[model samples]
Target: MELLNQFYANEKVKQTLVNFITDGRLPHAVLLEGEPGVGKNHFARLIAASSLCSGEKKPCGQCRNCRLVLQDTHPDVMLLSPDGADKPYSVHALRELILSCYVLPNDGDQKFYILRNVHEMSEQAQNTLLKIIEEPPPHVFFILTCQNHARILPTILSRVVTLTLWPCPVEICAQALKERNPDTDEEECLRLAKQSGGNIGRALSVLQDEHLSRIVKNAQEAAQLICDGKEFELLCLLNGYNRQKDDFLLFLGELRQIFVEALRQKYGASDKNFLPGAMLNRISALQTMRILDIIDKVSGEAAQNVSISLSGAHLCSALQQTLRG
Candidate 1:
């Protein structure tokens, strides 16, 4: 039942929501849309608690209603998610949720239904839920959390008040990391924050990934090898990556970041590139973009059930063309 006092970034979102809650103008249906690690779920819970809490200060953590919501024992709050090997919400499940909305609140004056991964709901399921929201019960409120809003139906999107969360700022992410893990080194926090692209969850996860340094080193080596026209060595390295999909992906990401820094360097912009000056000087901006295009194409192809060696071959051939171009 902690107040919405500390979302690391997105002050505009935080303040607008607080205004909605305090002004008693909160919408009946809210769509919290954002990337996976952007805290949409966390905000949904805070909104739910605020809606249900019966205190002098809404969601006063010590209030009985607030405590119940925080404990997840509140009878009026319903949490619906994909169930039983199903990746998407089923029509039957949506019907059940719709029916439950009609039931009287157990203790609180309001009932809140928090749906996770609403983007996974099928079109029919969304249509079914649409009917309920169209004329929602006076006591019921719906909060839907989704990573992609495009997957949701336009009609449903029209009904809900959509709030999109973007990546947190680097400083805010670093501060949040420091607050969460006091013993973590500040330098490491800043490095992770910078690498996370403003994603607090991603920054926190970077701290847990021990192989990050190895990936960075490998990326640097890959750049040097490609620039030196060591095709055989590069092919051998690519073959080695065939068995480690996650590491390969991380390596590719590091390679992209390095080239991005190189692009900044080319434009005389300050960057945190650790690549050797010789390697940076070897690749022009056009060459870098071409290489990145190859990587992106390979990444998309990898999504299919293709053989890893085939992808490795493609990568080697593409690198040759990029280097020559």
Candidate 2:
């Protein structure tokens, strides 16, 4: 429980995990699934620490095992992630990981393989992983994290214990932000909490990184333009990113999130204050869906190393046509 104390919200998940760990019934293969900023990585680490901690209270935070895991220096904990800009795990690398599963733990009775973003793995790479996870060595455990479970193979899903994480309430997230950053004003913290839809990691990034803040601002502005059906203005605004492909991609991601929030609001989900109520009211659910589709297309083109200027033009025209139609 102490290990998970820092992880806010999700009381049920915390208690469920606590019971499993206390009863020594923790699954050998665990899958943590959630949105990008929902703390899947944090939860994964907590589980790892709890399993390997030497002290009586699992993950006492003072024991050598716990400290090592916190510092990412634990010999028994291997953190794996996809490689390259496209973020695909190499089938060859995964095969090597499978081969290493049989090796005994170096520092403890058990070893943990923490694989981040397994959803990004190609089907071939996942199949390679399935070979080991299906019948992993008794001394080895696999902890996988992903933003989407739909991308994972059914066989993999059937083999792991899946836990889904969601954002905390806006007030709870704001209070957390205030506690972590005492120097920041309460109003600013609340604003960030609302803008990020209670996602602490997302709000914290905007607070700490000026570039990300700018990207977020640009994205919100773009969403407003889309709602207002301002094709020319939207084009002019997006044209500013012609030379900054990375920033443009980030903007697209933020824009997609805004539209998703708007769509949810249209369907009676509680507003996280991602946008002004007036703006949200202006866009219908169908229009939001169309915009999301267009954004996905543009994002795909951007990922393929397409010219940012060209993508921006296409996005503007497509959105305008969809909105008018």
Candidate 3:
């Protein structure tokens, strides 16, 4: 596939890879770790394309090599992602890759193997390929991608150069969305970009969430109702959200954003900035800080998934108190 235009944020990484390839000293094994959809796969493919391209500019993007890679038919290029990254890679798959590593490349310049979502490899699978990784064939190169670097085995981690990828800035993401879907409003796409928390995959995911629309709607209503001291209505909405335990924390996060935006407006931040308009000037700054503190606490606990039993009610009450103050 053509590298997504959204990958512009990763130009440094692409250049780094390009430099290494041009110098002919690129490591045999590499680990690409990042938030999902920040273009780990694209970076890997670009590097793979650069390695395979026989053109003067390497990845001239118009060569026979580039065309074959885009078609997923590069003779010396191999992709060995987990059967499903949401699941585990099998011992059989790892063994196959290991065996394939020993074979000479078909055209014989270099071999590129991409193992996407290496974190999903089972212990046995990781162990199966350790020997091959330890003594890789001279021309063989591996690119492993993962969302959670911690899930990968230390042995594997130690063996590869770990490349970290982060989400692109909102303006960049918005620019990209505008390029692909010209009809989409830039401001609206920026909102989605912020909600994505630095993951393009997540930004796209946010676009598809009916639940998010409801969550945003409910949070907006709760903010207005809380400001009006509509305790009963607020409690009803919170209680309804509390049932969908998995979504509660994210819901709280949205509430926190709205409240924080209101506070920013109180401090004279403008609408062009992301702060909510100054209608909430009555709420004190300290109250906003306290609600934010509670959000941080709840968000931390929620991330560990250990605090699921903790009621969002307490956080809601703190936000209510913040509004009331």
Clashing pairs in 2: none
Predicted candidate 1 versus true structure: per-residue lDDT over 1-325, tens digit per residue: 2476666667787777778888998899999998777898778877887877778666677788777787777788877776546533788767877888889888857889888888877888889989998889999999998988999999999999999887776677778889898999898877767655557876666676667766766777777887787888888877877867777777777777667666766776634333557877888879878888877777666656356678768988998987886
- Worst lDDT 10-window in candidate 3: 270-279
Task: Arrange candidates, best lDDT first.
Answer: 2, 1, 3
lDDT of each: 0.78, 0.88, 0.72
Instruction: Please identify model 3 stretches exceeding 4 Å from their true place.
Output: 1-6, 83-88, 208-235, 238-325
In terms of lDDT, model 3 sits at 0.72
Per-prediction TM-score to the true structure, in the order listed: 0.79, 0.93, 0.69
Worst 10 residues of 2 by lDDT: 83-92
Best by lDDT: 2
List runs of model 2 lying over 4 Å from the truth. 84-88
Candidate 2 global TM-score: 0.93
TM-score of 1: 0.79
State the TM-score for model 3: 0.69
**Clash count of each predicted structure:** 0, 0, 0
